[model samples]
Target: MTRADYVMPSNSELEAATPPLWSIEEQRPRISAVDLFCGVGGLTHGLVQGGIRVGAGVDIDPACRYPFESNNSATFIEKDVNELSGADLLQHFAPGDLKLLAGCAPCQPFSTYSRSGRSKKRGLDWQLVLGFGQLVQELKPELVTMENVPQLADHAVFQDFLGHLDGYHVWHSVVECSAIGVPQSRRRLVLLASKLGSDGLRLDTGDYGKRTVRETISELPPIMAGEQHAGDPLHTSSTLSPLNMRRIKASRPGGTWRDWEPELRAACHRKESGASYPSVYGRMEWDAIAPTITTQCFGYGNGRFGHPEQDRAISLREAAMLQTFPADYKFVRSGEKIQFSRLGRLIGNAVPVRLGEVIAKTLTSHVKMIFG
Candidate 1:
């Protein structure tokens, strides 16, 4: 026979021809899930740790592929989700097997920062959520979950999307991350939907008093200004210019540029034009949780990014830890130098692993109640 004629079947075809790979009768039922827009695979990592098998992750950013694959042991497909079809998804997951779809699409269009001053431009970014909705309608996964900035709940398109999932019992709430033991004051809208249950889905909130900044990052080895921690790839700090070093030296923990002497203040800070922006040049307090981390977290001028006690901005590793990624999560390849911009985006965009763990645990409990 020709080699072409004898070619082996792909994994999907073999899976379909064979009996169910995992049988609930013979073993503990494992909930299978797919993560869309899976940034850095934080949710995927947590889901796997929670006993849910993550089949694959889909994202448009190529930068996310390495960390996603490296950290989660899941396949990462770099493609715009709008171009994907139901057949593509069915290849990984068998029909009639318990299916779950989880996603937290880019929220820039609905973000509070983006709304500050700009005319609304509708385009592919706006269509992302609709694309996600279409996939849900086609695949009809038994359960669905999503997380995003609470501002998204105010959008009309988001409201319509919720209405379309009429057959599924859905529960949504604007959850405070601090209230969920995340150690930050960030608030996000979380939604859970189930087609199999009439009681709807709700995540249990644990006692919120356990986690704090001191408890989370206080124990790590300290690095000085413009220094990276030894043997820690993500613990690299940004270099400060001489003038900025003076400013940083004068900066008090939890204070802003207003604390500086008149001669040391930035010109814009003294001008009426910059009166409205108060968070710039601010430092975090060691005793309290840090401010909301953003994509520009490595830059000193970006929000309240100054280090609490150090004279430099918080390092990339600190940012990741604040996002609830484990201390040793591999952000870059071994022997490769870490790039701040690449690492910053990966850290900022990730769903905090701890938060994902909480969500996955709750969903798994729900699934076990029904099918286990």
Candidate 2:
């Protein structure tokens, strides 16, 4: 496919197409939410698709503004989570609608604190998750939900977060993204708290089955290492070093450094320290799901990001697709140069759109049970 075959819309075009939140006609007893730490509208998009209304998205990054607004039709507020209050979120909800406050707080600080044995006195970064709880307490939003790394379930802060839900019935579980149609082996801690009643919310078993890498992206035209597809700039791959190119060529699907000839293997892999780290610098299996897409997933040496049959790592667009973003989803505006770092971070950090849709579906069912 060529660029002409798929023209990304202009910023103005997307804005004009997006209906203002305030102008949307009210449905009686409807559910609307404001997404906190909403990176590039993944959850918002899924919520919209699941038949919920999203009024706005709040995040600290200015770069998130365009994609969050343009794709989701929700107002994107560029502000830190700590700076926000219930009033800031309350303004976004339609009068009489069930207010749902949803967020995915950053978990990096927890990892940092865990390493230092300072889990109790966590820094400002750890406070962001608590800030979500703060908003919940102040707004008393009828429904609340949060998503994060599954490992967070073991943290003291996670327990602290639960303490804020005194009057709410809550349920949380680790959700496998592939079960929800995301073509990646991603698992997330999904939590739901409701003020409505005793019967707690639960996610329905997904029907999608495990989607595979080939199924998700095989239709796209091929591009070599460091080459861009003429039809899709986002389909561009990073250039591999000559040695790395040789390494990738020697690598096999689902295979590790063991698959490579000794000369093609990295020096680190030659050491005992690397013996336990076989998952890195490997190619994805065409029939299997992809590894967790990380911020550096565009790089050939990062995780199992190499393409199954192609001699280069997967492209930025492929990574987004594995994250369940639509082929036409716009991360950058038309003619804006696509930076691998910026786009990769935005896509990787986002809650998979499919998982968000699953959350929305669960919440919508709960709303119906209460109101109807």
Candidate 3:
């Protein structure tokens, strides 16, 4: 399915104070999939949007259960990918249907940011990626895909993943999100492998043009720092300290904390060592692409997460939208209190739905060329 063909919540439905009741029509698609490490179902939602049927999503985080199941027509299996066997995943697919496995492993350990940190605790997380490859080797799925930080492209684990695809036609490259209609300036490594044929399938990186911050979030009703929009609870912004409030007020869009008065600048900002990290305490430019959304994006002090016009950091909903989630994609179930850290991690760690859609589209085209 194309973007125009994909259904979305109506404006009235989206504007409702609460999510609509969960319902999805039963489907028996020829192309079926199971999403591993499917945090909050961003990639699964995109697959569904691209006209693929996803049987279920697997992730260890129980917090992901609600959103993953609520937003899409798929079951949520709370299990670690490392512990899941190929047989465990195979049961979700129908016999004779094309099987697809998507695993976007946690990228923190392989991210450039993590490498710059002093901590070595995250070093072992890259091993989790190997489990995905193990499953692909055992299950011998008809198709497989993975997405991660571009830095991971050079990692040994990635080479090991390619090693698993002995009989499959594989292709991978770093895809820029702005090229695919996502509103953020994020780049990710994308891999696609197919056992269908020697047709030499490759991804199609279409020119959708750049999406800007103003184009993406300009229509939403504004809320101030520490306040939630009465109409939508998820539209709440993080409470800023008085010092941050003053600092943001002095800041201009696209400008850093250097714009602050000498008294308002953080001690770190005044220090020579802080000059390299200019993106911190910065506001996004309204008409330009947004900075990459990080897990701590709701905090104004985190990266360039400050709102272009508002005096607060972007809300969780704004971050989700920037990540290409639908306006009304429910993260928290109704009546559940929104937790900023948990929700932010789910949103930031998610594959941008637009990027996922592009991946799905590429798969769809390849499947048609091979099977039709």
Candidate 4:
């Protein structure tokens, strides 16, 4: 996104500003927000539940437009973030006096797994983060928020983003997402900032006790490999080879391929070096939080993604639920067959909606504390 020219609003201007809490409660002239890099509206849904009046979501993926619109009742624009301007967002707001802008920028660049060849591929995505900083510099919204993998907080790109907050009060932390009620183990770096000075701002952790894998998926109707739950098309599972059938059936929950008999071992696993990754070809523990659900979470061979005892890989819907999306969330149109590649990317890449809710509450409480 090209940077828009802007001047910092002075202290008198800041003091003259009305706290948005009034608009939220009176239900007229509501506080409005915009979400960038929104994927399938997971964070948007949670933000709505947290009480922000979201107006538009910007994402480059056309596939995101449907769910982002359907669930959040917000406009979804298909454009790269680098192409966006502060003016592009102004059109979406209602008659709100205060505005908030937020997003979870694409996180692959900072993910632990993607760290392998970071130097060459970092340009495009790295620019996206810089673009976000540029927008903040221009729009200077009353509030700013974002969710990304934890490693990002360590990078120079993030530090430069921090430098852009010249007069803003910022609260940031690396959070254990499971502790906040997401059913998978995800660690994310969350940043919340406000133009108001840092006096009373804080981000509180949720005390809602742990959510386990069984609590999430034990109730869904069972389906076999390559079969769709007759009632829910999204619950379809991928087919397993005859060899994989035996592999999964022999697999115990939370156990690795190390449990397999010598005859059943894949040639790769039999190699001495392959012993390093014990999580692959394993089943999830029924009573534990699931392993992090990745872009390839639906494929059993990719990780410990096998169904606990079903002798099949976890289905698409299961992966979505594990990511804290509601059971009824739709990724594709009705009567459309589920495409694992596209849909998996949507689910795996989404911010667990619960995480959004936490950010929402944090922002709400902070606003109330400072405004009142």
Candidate 5:
């Protein structure tokens, strides 16, 4: 299969095509939500699926503007979160109506993997979380939700931000993505805060069931290395270097390249400095969930983004599905180019839609118990 095979049909074609397998009518609504830092509307879409009406999504990235609007049918404001005011958000919804403010601030600075040697001197990236705190203080919505890498729990700034919530009841947990039905082993810090007090905000624990890679992507049409699903450009796989392709072929499921013969190893892999980074140049196992998909998911060297059995990186659709986005979720619109940088950022940065559904469900139950 060639790259063209995986290209997604134009947005107009998809819109004019059959509707999604699941419809908005199937969901049960409880509250209105505003998605801040709404990357491709993952949380917003999931909230919609769970019956919450998302009023608006705010983010600075232009790439997210289209997918967020297209998929959620919500207005997208392309602005940095720092620029938003409480009054600006109030216009989206009327007074006396129950409102929820949800955000997943950029996690790079708070991430354990940040390459800045855990130094606080790296200032710019670290300020994004501060911006989120500012908005929370301004909006003072009835309910608040935040999702981020678990590292955020340990950050002093985050602690201070929580303190600022004052009388609001807050419950936070470091949730494993697999436990929430996202077909990845990603762990995130999830928080749900409510002005309704302690009894109103808690997540109910559920049995952790495993979701395998095959269950997530096995049904998609097969394509060769570097090819897109013929019917969906957004489902295309990344091109691989010839040597890397050979290396992937020799790789065992869930095994790192260290399992291969010395000749197959990259030069860095042979160095002492590279010993600690065993997860790079790894292959995913068919029967297990994938490792956390990160911003650099399009790059094979980033982590275990390789196909379980195929000799190429996972496609955009596969990544989105692993993140628990519905298969038919519209990404690029009609006449738009599906650039990997833009698409990958959207997928990598999104809150897993399944995770969002769980959150919305929990919040809905809480609201009903308190104010229904």
Candidate 6:
């Protein structure tokens, strides 16, 4: 029989595809996954899109339950990963031929913000990383995957974590997230470990064309300062102070603070240290990838988050889109007022759904090669 003629959609149209998982129509075994630290189910959604049967997701934040469950056909279990046993997680999986345990522990400790050598204490964020390895060792799932900040692989904690997998073959790389279709330029460390004695796939950046910021959000309905788009409440932008509004109006896309009029310049911008952080208060370049979308991305003062032509910061919907969340992905329950801080954390902390799809595709291919 000849192979069916099929042309995959471009990166820009990835989310528009119905049912998310683009290749499940073919013969493939059931490979279920349990997402640990599944904030708002970004990884779970993308994994589902890549054809994995995600039975459930676990996270400490109870708020994630609605969005996680609403968007994907998966249960969201509210609990600290530390409190949950691998056996408990494994129970979510059916007697499938293959099971996967996936998670991306919090990356704050290894983030550039915390790299000033200022901390004398190690918090649960670090502990969570170690705990991830512990669970993997305990459960010994046939396939394993994790995604985190690129700096994580350099940490001594990461080294010790690797030691736990004595016999598992590991394949890992520092992934340039934007290259893999995420609309923002973010780098992450991704690891795939397998007890199957074969190396798993590492996603290829060259496989697809890059998406641009304009393509991701330029079509989103406009919103004024402190106003939500009537079309979609989630498209609400943060209200700017009088001075900030003027500053954004004077700003040019991709331009820095130096481009602003002297009268609108903030006191900090005049300082020598501020030159290193030029992207703050800057408008995004429409044709390029966005700067990394952080938890505070809804604020104009955070990174280059200003709208390219509008006189306001990027809205919640825009930020989510840059993270490659589907246009219709729900972040709030019915009648729930969208909280900026909570939504920001959810969108920023999420693994870009597209990147998750890349990981899922990699895992699915390896499993099929070895099992089918």
- Highest TM-score against the true fold, candidate: 4
lDDT of each: 0.77, 0.84, 0.84, 0.82, 0.78, 0.83
lDDT of 3 by residue, 215-237 (tens): 99989999999998877789999
Clashes of 6: 1
TM-score, structure 6 vs. true: 0.90
Error of 4 at 99 (Å): 1.5
What TM-score do all the candidates reach, one by one? 0.87, 0.89, 0.89, 0.90, 0.87, 0.90
Question: What residue runs in model 2 are displaced by over 4 Å at the alpha carbon?
Answer: 1-28, 110-122, 198-200
Residues 1-372 of candidate 6: C-alpha lDDT, one tens digit per residue: 002222344544445533343344644345779999999988999998987888899999988998999999888999888887888887777552367889999887777655555363347688888888888888888778889988878779889888877787788889888888898889889888877646445664546678999899988877799998777889999899999988898889999989987888888988888788888889999999999999889999988999998999989999999999999999987678989999999999999999889888888777666544
Mind giving the per-residue lDDT tens digits that candidate 1 earns over 1-372?
Answer: 111222343456446733553453633234578899998988888777776677889999988888888878678989999999767886666443467888898887766556543345445556888788888888888788888888778888688678758799898889877766776667888888887674426876767563666777777777876787777867878888887788888888878888888887788898987677777878877778878877778888777888887788888988888888888888788777878888888788788777788788888777655544
By the TM-score metric, which is better: model 3 or model 4? 4
Q: Give a tens-digit lDDT track for model 5, residues 1-372.
A: 112222333445435533321123522224678898898998998887776778899988887777888787688998988888988988765233457999898877766656665566446545777777777788888788898888878778788778767768889999887986788988989999987656647665466488899989999887777887768877888888988888888887788888878998988988998788888878888898899987777767778888877788888888889889989888987656768877887798899998888888888778656643
CA RMSD (A), model 3: 7.9
Residue 364's lDDT in candidate 4: 70
lDDT of 6 at 336: 84
- In model 4, the Cα lDDT at residue 316 comes to 95
Note each model's CA RMSD in angstroms.
Answer: 6.7, 8.8, 7.9, 5.5, 10.1, 7.1
Better of 2 and 4 by lDDT: 2
Error of 1 at 36 (Å): 0.4
The number of residue pairs in model 1 that clash at the backbone is 0
**Error in Å for residue 361 of model 4:** 0.6
Per-residue lDDT tens digits for candidate 4, residues 1-372, read 001222334455445544442343433223568898999988888888887778899999999988788777788899998888888788776543457788988877777666766776687788888888888888878788878888889889999888877788898898888898888888888898887546545556758778999999989999999999878999998999999889898899999898989898888888998788899889999999999999888899989899986889999999999988899987878888789988889999998988888777777766555555
